[model samples]
Target: MSLHSVFERLAARPWLAAFVFGAASALALPPVYALPVLLLTIPGLLTLLGRAKGWRQAAWIGAWFGFGHQLVGLYWVTHAILTDVAKWFWLVPLAAPGLALPMGLYSILPALVAWRLAPGWPRVLGFAGAWVLAELLRGWAFTGFPWNLMGTAWAFAPLPMQPAALIGAFGLSFFTILLAGLPLLGARRAFGTGGAILAVWMGYGAWRLQGLPPQGTGAQLVLVQGNVRQDLKWDPSHRAAIFQRYVALTSQGAAAAVAEHPEAPVLVVWPETASPFLLAQDPEAIRIATEALPPRGLLLAGTVRAEWGPDGRANALANSLVVLDADGQRHGLYDKSYLVPFGEFMPFGGLLPIRLAAGGMDFSAGPGPSTLPLPGGLPAPGPLICYEVIFPGEVVGAERPGWLLNVTNDAWFGNSAGPYQHLASARMRAVEEGLPMVRAAQTGISAVFDRAGREVARLGLGETGVLRAELPAAGPPTLFGRWGRWIPGGILILSLAVALLLGWRRPSQV
Candidate 1:
C-alpha cells in the first residue's frame, strides 16, 4: 500500500529491476554524467542479489543487468554498421545486442559470488570484488574489448580520478563499487566510513595537483582533425581531396604553433590512417606530407603498412604509424598490435563470410608494445592505435617513454558516445602512467592531457580543426605504472578475503 512497499515489490522482480537499474547506471559515465542516479541503481541491484534463492537466479539477474548496461552503453556500435547500410542492413539492428551477449556473461561470476556471501557488508564487499574480478577477466578474454569499465564513471572529473595514479583504473573500480554498495545496508557507521574515503580521494587529488609538473620544453603538438565522412573516406575519387585536407590543416596549424613557441620544435600529428596513399611506399606522398611541416617540424601520421614476402609481393597488411622529417625521411615506424575482431580481422578464419574492415585481406598484428625513438632530440613516445588505448596498465613497455601517443579513426562510429568514451579511457591511461597523452583523432575529440590527466587542449566531436599545445613533461612513474596489474591484483585478493572471512563469521539468511 505504501511507496516503500511498491518499490520493494518492483525490486523483488529480479529480471526487470536488475536490467532497469543496470541501464540507469550507464548514465553515470561520460557525455551525460548523471552520478546521483547510481544511489538507487547500485543499491537496488544489491537488494535483488541478496534476495536471490540460488546461484542460478543470481546469475540470471546479473546477466540481465549486464545486458541492459552494455546494450545502452555500446549502442553506438550500430552506427558503425549503419555506415554501409545497403551491404549490412540487417546487422545494424543486431550489432549492439550481439556485442552485449558475451559482455553480459561476465556479470555471472560476480552475481554468484554475491549470492553465496552473507547479507550486509560481507555481500556488498564480496560483490564488489567479484565485479572487478569479472572486469579483469573480460578485459583479456577472447582478444578483449575493455570498453566502459565502471571506474570511468569517476572519469567525468579529475578529482576522483587521482587514485588511478596509485592503484590504476581497476583498483579505482574496486573502490567505486565498494563505496556504491555501502548505502544498501543502511548503517550510519558504514555511511560515515564511505564519506571519509571519498574525502580522502578528493584530498589526494588536490594535493597531487599542488605539486603538478610544469609543461615540458619539448616539441609542441599540432593535432589535425580532417572530419572526413566515413562513407567517403575510402572512395578512390576522394582520396586526393582527403589527403590535401590533412596537409592543408597541418601547414596552417604548424605555422601557428611555431609562432606561439618559437623555441619548441613542432610535431604535427594526424589521426589513424589519415593518409590516403601508402605513406611507407609512396615517396611522392611522403614528400607532399613533409611540405606542410614547419622548418623544424616533424609529422606523425597513421597509414597502412604493407609486409612483403621473400618473393617481393605484399603478403600482409598492418595498421601503422610513421614519423617523417622535412627531408622526407621516415624516422620511426610503429604498427598497431591489438587488432579489433571482425572490424580489423575476421574471426574463425573468415568462415563467417563477412568482413567489416575495408580491405579483402586481414591485417597482421604487430609485436606487443614498443617505445619509438624520434629525431631532432624529441622525447621518445609509446604509440597506441585506436582502441588499444582503452587497456589499462598495458599502454607502455618495459622501456618507459616520455609520453603517450594515441592515433584513432573515430569516424567509423560517427558523432556518438563511442568517441567520448574512447577519449575518457585515454585520459585514464595518462593518469595511470604519469605521462602526458597526445591524442589525434579523425572527426574531432582531438585533445592533449598532461601527466596529471588535466586537459590542456581539446577539439570537440564532428569538428574539423587543429589543436595546438605544448607537450607536458612526464612525471616519475606512478605506483600503478611501476606495479602494473599487481596493485589491482592485491586489492582483489584483499576484498575477497574480507568478504569470505566476514561472511563466515556473520552468517545471514537469503
Candidate 2:
C-alpha cells in the first residue's frame, strides 16, 4: 500500500480524521507536551484540506480539527462549570461544544483562505499563514482568548522556546505551523528541509541558553498560595475562613523573613480576588491585614475595590490588587485591565443566557499594563491580574517596571491542565519582557520565574503553601520587547511572498 492510499482512506472520513489528529496534537500542550505529535497532525490536516470537495468543506474540516484541538486542550473550562454543578449542570453538555464551535471558527476561516490560493507548498504555507492568522485573530477578536496556542507546546522545554525572546510567541507559532506542515510533501526534499529547520530551531535555542549567564541571585519575595476551593469561595459562610487563611499565610511569610533578613522589605503576593470583602469599604479586613504585615514589608493582595456612588451604591467595582504597608494603609492599587469577556463581563452580556463572576453588576476594567509603586516607592512592579499575564508585548507598557507580578484565581479551573498552561504563558512573558515574574495563584502552582524563563522556585498544584524565593533578576531588553508584533508580522508577509513566488500547484490527493 502506498502513502496515497493510506491517506485517501483516512481522508474519506474527514471529520473523524481531523478530530483524532487535532486531539492528538493537543497532547503537545502543557502537562502532556507530546511535541512530536505536531509533525503528524499538521500533515494530516493538510491532507484533509487538499482532498476537500470545496472551500466550504475545507472550512468545515479545519473547524472540526480545531474543535477537537480546543475540546481537549481546554477541557478545564468545564471544570469551572463543574464548580457550581447545581446551577450550571445544564451547561456541562453544551459548554465544551459551544465554546469549541466559535473558537474553531477561527481555524475554519483561515483554512478556507489557504485552500483558495492554488496548492502544493503554496497551499502548505497558506495553511500555516491562515492558521497563525486565525490564532492571532482569535486572541484579538472577542476580547481575545489566546489559550493553548501552538507555540505554547514548547513551554515545558526551554530549548525550542528560547527564540521566543526575539520573535515573541506568535513568531514561534508561525515557524511551528510552517515547519510542521513541510513534511506533508512526503518527498526527500521536503524531509531534508523540515529536518534542517528543526535543527536550526533547536540550535538557536541552545545558543540562546548558552548565552545566559549563570543564574544570579534575586530579590526577596513571599508568595501566598491559599488553596481556596472555587465552589466554597463565594459562599458567605466561607468568606471569613478565606480571609483568615491569606492573613495567616502573610504572617507566616513575614515571620520567616524576619528571621532571615530582619531589616529588609519582603514583598508579599496573593492570588486574584483572594479577599472576598469590599476591601476599601471594610475596616475589619484592614485591621486584620495590618496586624500581619512586618516592618519594612509590603503586602500585595487581590481584593475587590468598590467605588461608591453618591447615592450610596457601588458606582463601579474593580478586581484589584491592593498594596498595603504595615499599618495596612492603601499604598497602591492596580486593577485588572484585560477582563475576560464571559468570565469577567459577558459580550452582548444582557442578551446572553450566562453571566459569570457572581450575579452582580459588571466589574469595571482598570487601566492596566500599568506599574505599581512599591511600599517605599521602589522601581515598581508591573501588575498582571489573572488572565492578563497571557499577553506577550502588552504586559509591559511605556514605563517599564523593575519586575512583574501576576495575581490569578485558577481555582475556578480546579486541579487541571489550566493552571499549568497559565504558568507556561507567564514564563513566556518573562522571557519576552526580560523581567522576572512573581505568580501568585489561589489553589497552588505559585511560582517565581527569572527573566530567562527558568523556574527559580515553585509550589505545586492543589497544595497549600507559601513559596519563599528571591525574585530573580531581569535580563537586558529582549528583541520581542523592543520590536513587539512586527517580528511575527514580517514572518507572515514573508511566508505569503514565498508561497506566491514558488507558484501554487494542486498537491497530490494522496
Candidate 3:
C-alpha cells in the first residue's frame, strides 16, 4: 500500500496512530538512538496535520502525537516511582500520563498554528519553528522539565551536537524538526536539504574539535561511584556502610591515580549524598573521610548543607557540593540552584518546618553558578549538583569555571535508561559550554567528558567503581556561552513568525 493511503487510514483515528508516531520518536533518544526513524514518523505527522479540517482537529492530532512522544520518552519516571512502590505504586500509571498531558500540550499549540497558516515549505518551516517554541516554553514554564528536546536525537552522533555550541539545544531542535518535516517534500528535496544540513553540521564539529590540545589540562580527578540503592540510601542503619564504601573507593582511586600521574594533583569525588549524615556537623565522619585523602589532595563531594537559624534551630537546607581540604575542614560549598520541582522542593505541596534534616524534608533551591575555590591557584571547577548540568548557559556564571563538576544521585532511576538519558544531557552541557565535565553519580553511569563531549572515562549503571582520569581542559568559551541561549532560540522564533505570516497569506490545499 502507498504511504499516503496508510497515513490517511491511520489519520482517521489520529489519537492512537499519532501515539505510535510519538513512541517511535523515543527511539531517536539515547540508548536507542535510531534517529532515522524520525524521517518516517514526522513526515507522516505533518501530512496528517496537513489533512486536518480545523484548528481544533489539528490540535487534537498534535496533542495525541505529543502525548505518545512524551509518554514513551518519559516512561523512566515510572521506574523511579516503582523503586519505592510501597508508597508510590498507585502513582506509577498516573506518573506517565500526568506528566505527558502537560508536556503534550506543548505540541498542541504549534501543530494547530502551523496547520492554519502553513503549507508546503512554509508549513515545514512553521512546524519546525513551532516545535522549538514549544520546547522553549516547556523549558521555562512552571518550573521547567525540558527532558527530551528534538535536538537530543543527534546526541548519539557527536558531530551534530557541536551545533549546540553555536545555537543552544533549542536551535538544534528547530533544525531537527525542520529536517524531519522536509521528507514531506518528496525524496529529492528531502535528501538534498537533509544532506546539506548534515554536511554543514559535520564541518562545524570538525572545525571545533580539530587541533584541540591532546594533553590533559593538569587537573586529574577520581570520580567515586557508590552503587547505593534508593531504598537503603537513606536508612540510618546503612549510612555507616555507605560512607565506608565511598571512602574506601576514594582512598584506592586517589592512590592509584597519584601513582600513575605522580606529578598531577589528584582530587577525590563522591556522588550526590554519598555521605548521608552531615559530614560538616559530625567530626567523626569528617575524620574518616579525610583519612582517605592524600596530604595535599582535595575531596569534592555532594551532601546536604543546613543553615542554622540564629535561635540554634536549622532553617534552610541545600543540596550542595562541598569541597574539603586534606584536614577534612570545608573549603567551599556550591549549592544546587535549579532544584527539581517535586524531588527537591514540593511544588504546590505545602511547606513544612526543618527541625532535624534527618527526616524526610524537601531542599530549598540554592544560589547557582557558585564556583568553589580549589587548592591550587588553578582554574576553579564549578559544581553542578544533579540536574543543574542539564541547563545550558546557566552552567557558567560571570566567572566561567575551568570545568563542570557534575555530581548526581541517579539511584532513584535505578538501572534503567534514566541514567543513560541523564548522562546524555551532561555530555550536551559539555559541548554547549565548551567545558569538560566530570560527573559522579550514585548507582551508575558516572563519566568524564571533554569540551567536545567525548567520553574520556565512564562507569556504567549499578557498577561500584571510581573513574580516574585527567580532566580535559575547557575550550574557548562557546558561542552558546558567549551569546547566551536565547540568541539561537530567538533566531528560530523569528523564522517561525515569518513562516506563520507567509502561511497566513496563502491557504494550504489538502
Candidate 4:
C-alpha cells in the first residue's frame, strides 16, 4: 500500500492513529523541539477528524488524541508520586493519565467546531481557533494548568521566541496551529502560504534580535542549587543536613559572587523550599540563612510560612518567598498565589478521599500577583513560585516589576524533561514582558535569561553548584506587556470569526 493508504487505514481505527499522532505532536514541544514533525502530526489529526463518522466521533477522536498528547507531556508527573511510593504506589501509573483525562476534555470543543467547517480553509482555521480557545479556557478554568502550550515549541532559542514580545505565547499558538494545518487538503496555495508565513515569522524574529545585547543592571545574582532529593527534602532526620548544605553553598556562592563583582549588589537565591526548617517561624533559621549574605547583600529563600494559632498549633501554611538582609532582618515576603493542584492543595478538598500533598493541611494561598521593592537599591522583582511561571500573561501585576524571580523544586521529576520545560516557560515570560528572569530550581536547570529571552547562564540538572551572573537590564515594555492577553485573545477571536463566516458561506460535506 502507498503512504496515503496506510495513513487512511490507521485513521480508520478509532483509537490507534489519533492517539499516536497526538503523542507524536508533543515532540514539537520543549526539550525535544522537533517542530517539523507538526506538519505530519497536525495534518494527520485533521485527517483523522475528517474520517470520523459524526460530531460525537470527532469529539472522541480529539479527546483520544489529547489524552495521548498530554500523557506523554505529563508522564514525568509519575516521578513525583513515586517519591513516596509506599503510600502512592498504586497511583504511580495513574498519575499522568489521571491528569491527562481531564486535560483531554479541553480538545473536545475544538474538534466539534472543526467538525462543522469545510474540509479546506474553514476546517483548518476553525480547528486552530477553537483549539486556542480551549487552551485559554484551561488556562483560567479550575485555577489553570497551562503546560506545554503550542507556542512554547518555539522556545528552542531566542530568535523564534521574539514574537512572544508582540503577541505573547497564546498568540504564537494561534499562528503555529494555523500554519501547520494549511496543507490539510493538499492545496498548492496553502503550501506556499504556510512556507511564506513561516519565513516571515522567523525573519521578523531575527530582525527583532539584531540590536545590541542588553546591558547589566549593576546587580549580581548567586543561584544556589542544593541538589536535594525530593524524598529526603522533608525528612525530619535529614532536615539538619539539608539546611547545612544550603548554608554552606550560600556562603561559598556569596563570597565568590562578591569577589567577581565587588561594586555590584549581590543577591543570593535559594530554590523553592530549600530551607528544611520554617524560616518564618524559626528565628535561628533566619539567622543561619542570612549568615552567608555579603554586606548590603540580600537573600530570597523559599520556605513554608505558617500562621500559628494561640493553641500552639499552626492554623494555616503558605508556600512563600521571603527576602532577608545580612543583618537577619526580613525585607519582604511574597506568598505563592498559584498553588499547584494536588501537589500543594487537593481540588474540592472534602470530596477527595486521599491527600496528595505532603501534609494533612492544604497550603493557604496568598493574594494575587504583586510587585515588591527590594533593598540595597536593587531592582524590584515579581516573584513566581514553582509552576506559577508556567502561566503566561499572569506573571506580573498592576505595576510591572524590574525583573522576574522563579523558585521551584524540579527534583520531583528528576532527570526528566519537566524541569527543562519549566525553564522554557520562564524564558517565554521574559520575552513577553521584556524583562529579565532569574530562575532557581532545586536539583537542576537553574538559569538566568535576559530581557530578550537570551540565556545568560545555567546549571544543568542533578548538579550541585552556584551560578553567578550579573542581572541583565530590563528592556523596554513589549506590545504584549502593555496590552497583556488582548493581542492573543483578539487573534483567537478573529481567526474563529473568519472560520465561522467561511463555513457559513461554504458548507462542508464531512
Candidate 5:
C-alpha cells in the first residue's frame, strides 16, 4: 500500500489507532529498537488525531490513547501487587488503570496542542513540539513520574543520544519526538530533516565521546544482586535468610574482584533494603555487614534508619545509603531526599485510600543533597535509591559527582517490564550527567553504564549474580550536569512560546 493510503486506512478506526499507537510507544522500552520507536510515536499520535471527529472527540480519543500507552508501557506496576498478598490482587485492577488514567491526562495536553496548532509542510514540528510539551508536563506535574520517556529508548545507544548531556533527557526526548513525527511528512522531505537532525546529534555525540577522558584510574566495583523475594524481603521471619543471601552475594563479589583486580580494592554495592532490619537499631546486623566486607574493600548498601523525635511517634524513618569502610567502619550516610508516594510516604497521610504500603513505617524525607565520600578521597559519588533515580534533573545536582550510584530493590516489581523500564531511567541519568553509573539491584538487572549511558556489562533481570566492572572516572562536567535543568527548561519554554505565537497569528490572519 502507498504511504498515504496506509495512513488513511489506519486513521479510519480511532480505537484501533489508539491501541496500536499505545503499543508502538511501548517499543520505546529497552531490548527493542528504541531509536526507531521515536519515529513511531508521532505517526501513532497523528493517526489517532486524524481519526478524531472534532475537538471534544479528539480529547477523548487522545485520553484513551494516552491511557493505553501508559497502561501497557507501565504494566510492570503489577510487581507492586506481587509484593503484598492483600495489595497484589487489589492493585492488579486498581493501580494499572488508575495510574494510566491520570498519566493519560498529560498525553491530552500534547493532543490538544497538535489539534490546535495544526502546522503544514512540516507536520512533525507541531506534533513533536506538542508531544514534548506533554512530556514536560508529565515530568513536572503531580510530583512527576518521568518514567518511560521516549529518550530512555536510547538508553543503550550513546552515539545518537549523547546530546542528552547538553539538553538533558527531556531534550533528547523532544528530538526523538521530532524525528518520529518527521515520517508523516513523507520520505523525501521528512528524510531531509530527520537525516540532518540525526547527523548533527550523532556528530555532537561523537565529539563528546572522543573529547572526554577518564579523570583517574577507574575503580573496580562489584555490584551484588541478591535474588531475595519481595514477600520475604521485609518479613521478620525471613530476615535472617535475606541477610544471609546478601552476605553470600557480597562475599562472591569480593572473591571475584580479588581474582580479577587485586591491585584496586573492590567497592561492593548492595541494593536498597538489602537488609530489612534496621542496622542502627540492630547492632548485630551491623556487625555482620562489617565482618562481611574484605579488609581492603568498602561496602555501600541501602537500609532503613529511624530516629524518635520529641513527638513520641517515630519522627524520622529514612531510606538511606550507608557506606562502610574496608574494616566495616561507617564512613558516611545519605538519607534519600526524594521518597516515593504511597510506596515510601503516604500522601496527605491517611486521607488517601492507598496507605503507606512498603517500608512498614511511615517514611520521612531526608535532608539536602549530599555526596558519599569514596575511600581514597576521590570525587564524591551521588547516591539515589529506587524512585529517586526517576527524577531527571533533580538527582545529580550542582555538585557533579564522579559517578552516580543507584541502589534499587526491583524485587517489588518481580519479573515484569517494570524492572527493565526502571533500569532504562537509571541509564538515562548516566547520559544526562555524562557520568558513569553503577546500579546494584536486589533482584536483578545489575549493570554498569558509561558516561554516555552505554551498558558495558549487565546481569539479566531476575538473575542472582554479581558483576565486577571498572567504574569510569569523571570526565569533563556535562553541560546539563554543570548548569542543571536550565537547558531543558529553556527548550520547553521556547517550544511552547512558538506554538502559542503561531496559534495566535493563525486566526486573525484567516
Candidate 6:
C-alpha cells in the first residue's frame, strides 16, 4: 500500500491508534525495548492529536490514549490488588482503574493543546510545546505522578541527558516530543521542518553534555537489597529474620567493598523498611545493627519512627532514614517528606474504606528537604525514601547535595516491571539534579547511577545481592537542583503565551 493510503487507514480509527500508542509507550520501559520507545511515542501522539476532527474529538482521542497509556504502563497496580483477594473484585474496579483514570487525564491536556494550536504553527514545535505543557501538569496537578515521562526512557542510554539539569525532565520531554513529531511533519512532506527539529534537538543535547562536567569519583559505596517479602516486611513474626537478612547483606557488602578498595570507608546503604522493628524502640536491635557495620564506615538504613503527641492522640508514625557513623552512633535522621498515598499513609484518614486493607498505614509526612551532615563537614547528602524520588524538581532543594541517597522497598510490587520502572525514575532524578544517586531497594534492582543517568553498577531485579561501587564526587550545582521547578514552569507559561498570542492574531484559523 502507498504511504498516503496507510496514513488514511490509520487515521480512520483514532482509538485503535491510541491503544497501540499507549502500549508502545509502556514498552519503552526497561527489560524490553530501551530508549527507542521514546522516539516512537512522540510521532504516535502527534499523529493522533493532529488528525483529530475537532476539539471535542481531540479530547476523546486524548482521553482514550491517556487511559490506554496509564492502563498498560501502570499494570503494577494489579500487584497491590492481589495482596487482598477479598477486595479483588471491588478494588480492581475502584482502586486500580481509579489510579489510571486520573493519571490518564494528563494525556488529554496535550491533545487539547495540540488540537488548538495545530496545522498552522510548525507541527513539531506546537506538539513539543503542548506535550511539555501536559507533562508539567502531570507533575504538578493533584500532587503529581511524574513517573515514566518520555525523557525517562533515556535513563539507560549513554547520553548524559544533563540538559534536564538546566530545564528539568519536563523540558527534556518537550525536546523528545519535538523530535518525534518531526517525523509526522515529514510524513506530510515537510522535510525542511523535520530536519530542523531533529537538528535543534541533537545540537542542544550535544551542547548540554559538553557544559556539564562529571561530578564525583571513586568513593566506595554499598547498596544492600535485603530481599524481604512484602507480606512479611511488616509482620511481627518476621522481624528477627528481616534484621538478620539485612545484617547479612550489609556484612556481605562490607566484605565486597573491603576486597575492592581496602583504604576507602564502606558506605553501606539499606533499603526502606529494611528494619521491620523500629530502631528507636528496639535498643537491642540497634545495638546488634551497629556492631555489624565496619568500624570506619557509615550505615544508612530505613526504619519506622513514632512520636507521641502531648495529648497522646495516636501520635505520628514517620517513614524515616537514619545515618549511623563508624562508631555505631546515630549521626542524623532524615524523615521522608513525600509519603505514598495509601501505602505509606492514608489520605483523608477515615473518609475511605482503604484502611481495611492489609498493607495500608497512617504514616505522617516528613518536613521538607534538608541535608544530612557528613563527618568532617563535607557537603551534606540529600536523602529520599521510596516514592519521594519520583518528584523531579523537589528532591534536591535550594542547597545542592554531594549525592542523592534513595532508600526504597519495591517488594510490594513483586517481580514485575514495577521495580525496573521505579529504578528508571530514580535514575532520571540523578540526571535532573546533576548528582550521582545511590539506590537501595529491598528485593531488587539495587544500583548506582551517575549524574548523567548512566547505570554505573546494578544488581538485577528479584536478585538477592549486594551492589558495591564507588560513587563519583559532586558536580557543579544543576540549574534544576538550585532553582527547582521554576525553569520548567517558565517554559510552560511562555509556550502558553505564544500559543495565545498566535491564536489572538488569527482568531478563527485553528
User: Candidate 1 clashing pairs?
Assistant: none
Q: Per-residue error at 338 for model 5, in Å?
A: 1.8
Q: How close is every model to the real structure, measured as TM-score? A: 0.97, 0.94, 0.95, 0.97, 0.91, 0.89
lDDT of 2: 0.81
Residue-wise C-alpha lDDT for candidate 2, range 324-399, written one tens digit per residue: 8787788788888898766777778468868656856788998768887775555488999999988767899788
- The list of candidate 5 runs beyond 4 A from truth reads 1-16, 34-41, 47-53, 121-123, 213-218, 309-313, 356-360, 499-510
Output the TM-score of candidate 2: 0.94
- Cα error, residue 308 of model 6, in Å, equals 3.2
Which pairs clash in model 2? 139-144, 219-471
Q: List lDDT for all candidates, in order.
A: 0.88, 0.81, 0.81, 0.88, 0.75, 0.73
- Candidate 1 RMSD to the correct structure: 1.8
Query: Model 1, 289-383: lDDT tens per residue?
Result: 99989779889999999978999978999999999998888889998999988878999877886677688888899997889998867888899
The regions of model 2 sitting more than 4 angstroms off are: 1-7, 117-119, 214-218, 505-510
RMSD in Å for candidate 5, one decimal?
2.8
lDDT of 5 by residue, 87-118 (tens): 55766777778778888777777776666655
lDDT of 5: 0.75
Cα deviation of 362 in candidate 1 (Å)? 0.7
Reference-based TM-score, model 5: 0.91
- Alpha-carbon lDDT of model 4: 0.88
- 1-510 per-residue lDDT for model 6 (tens digits): 996686567678987777667767777655454555655665766777766767788888888777877777787877776666565657765665678788887777777777776454545565567677777778777666777777666565646365677777777776666655555545664467656755765676677666655555555788888787776666788878878888887887787787778877778888887887777556777787777777667888888888877896447788889888765678889888776666666677556656533444477777877778877554467999987888888887556678999898887777777888888788878877878888988887788887766677888778887888888766667778777777877776676677556643232564
Off by over 4 Å in 3: 1-5, 310-313, 349-358, 505-510
Tens digits of lDDT, candidate 3, 415-445: 6777888888888888888888889999888
- lDDT (Cα, 0-100) at 428 in candidate 5: 79
Deviation of model 1 at 168, angstroms: 0.8
Residue 5's C-alpha lDDT in candidate 1?
A: 88
